[model samples]
Each structure stands twice: as C-alpha cells, then as structure tokens.
Target: MSIPENARKYWRANLKYLAVLLLIWFAVSFGCGILFKDFLNRYSLGGFKLGFWFAQQGSIYVFVMLIFVYVWLMNRLDKKYGCNEPNSRKK
Candidate 1:
C-alpha cells in the first residue's frame, strides 16, 4: 500500500535527519572511539578514560538525545509545513 502524501513528506524529512545523525554517531563512536582512541585516552573524565567512556556510554546517551531532539524538531517542522493535525473546538 502507498503511503499518504503527508506521511511520505514527513518520512522523507525524517530519513534525511536520521542519515545525518547516524553519520555523526558513527564518526564519534567508531572514529573517535577506535581510530583516535589513543589520543582521546590522554584525557580522563572522572575515573573513566574519555575514549572508553564514549565508546561504552557517551554514544548511547547521544543517541537518546538525538531521538528527543528529532521529535521536537519534527513537531516544529510539522507546524511550519502545515502537516500537524488541526484541532477541533468543542462546544
């Protein structure tokens, strides 16, 4: 079954955002965690090595934050693009 036009537009916009976010996530998680790990380990946060923390925890936190941010941004986009459902007034 084909998606409704509004849904297609919303999904296309969301997909673009997801692609960019995933790229950044991969760069930080893989590139910084493994490739530049030695350099990153030179810094420490609390008792944890910075690179280790990022590899183990920071990326997960960033991913969660991205989800919330995406929801907020998409809500705004829906309003701006008139894709948000209209509210009905009650008597």
Candidate 2:
C-alpha cells in the first residue's frame, strides 16, 4: 500500500522544519564557533571571549534550546495535520 497524500504533505513539512532548525544549529555551532571566531572575539560575554564562549558553551546552550523549539514546532505541526496523540498535553 502507498502512503496517503496528507501523510506525504505532513512528512514534507516535518522535513522542512528539521532542515531549517539543523541549518540554524550548524550556523551557530560551526559559523560562530569557528569561521567567525576571530570577529566574535572582539566582544566579551560574562568576561569570556564571545567566540570562545560560543565554541565552548553557547553551542551547547543553543542546541538545548533548539530541542525545545523542535518539540514546540512538531507539536503545532502534529495538531495541524491531526496527527497528535490523543492524550498529549497541551500548553
């Protein structure tokens, strides 16, 4: 049996969300942590060099935040596509 069109659309939307979120993570984790490190070093964050902070701490923080963001987006997506768990909590 083949997948339904609504399922296909839902999957496509999910992938789009993943791609955007991952792209943002990569830009922060790699771009800020490495490529822009020199430029970022010109500033300070809590007495730490901005680039070093991003490389060592900021990326991790952003990744955690992204986890929550992904969950929130997926929740909305699930609701939109009528695919959410029947007992799932809403906020």
Candidate 3:
C-alpha cells in the first residue's frame, strides 16, 4: 500500500529529527563518557566527575528532556500538519 503524502512528509521530518537527536545522545553518552572520559574527567562539576556524571545521571536527565521535547514538538507538528484531533466541548 502507498503512504499518503501528508504521512510521508511527517514521517520524513520525524525521522530527520530522530536521527539528529540519537546522534547527539550517542555523542554525549558514549563518545564523551567512554571515548573522551579521561579528558572530560579533568573538569569536575560539584563533587562529581564530569564524564562519570554524564555516563550515570546526566544522560538519564538528557533522555528525560528528550522525551518531553519530543512530545511537545510532535504536538506542534500535528497542529501544523492539521493532524490534531478536534476538541470536544461539553454543553
């Protein structure tokens, strides 16, 4: 079955956003925490090693932020694309 043009557009935009976000997530979580850990550890934030914090807590926080951002962004996209459902008003 062929996909609708509107759906294809939305899917393409979503895929683009997902790819960029995943790249950033990987860079921060694995690249900085594992690959460049030693250099990053030289900088401390509060009593935590920078790389350690990123590997442990920081990445989790970023993941949470990404969830919220994705939801907000997708909602906006839905409205923009006229894909949002109409609100029901109770009389």
Clash pairs, model 3 backbone: none
lDDT of 3 at 61: 82
In model 1, what are the clashing residue pairs, if there are any?
Answer: none
Better of 1 and 3 by TM-score: 3
For candidate 3, lDDT tens digit of each residue in 1-91?
Answer: 9977887998888888788788888888898789988988999888998989888887888888888888887888878777777762223
Off by over 4 Å in 3: 86-91
What is candidate 1's lDDT per residue for 1-91, written digit by digit as tens?
8867776787788888889888888887897788888898999988899999888887888888878888888888788667677662223
lDDT of model 2, residue 65: 97
lDDT of 1: 0.81
Model 3 TM-score, all chains together? 0.85
RMSD in Å for model 2: 4.2
Which portions of model 2 miss their true places by more than 4 Å?
Answer: 86-91
lDDT of 2 by residue, 1-91 (tens): 9988888999999999999999999999999999999999999999999999999999999999999999999999999988798865444
Best by lDDT: 2
RMSD of each: 4.0, 4.2, 4.1
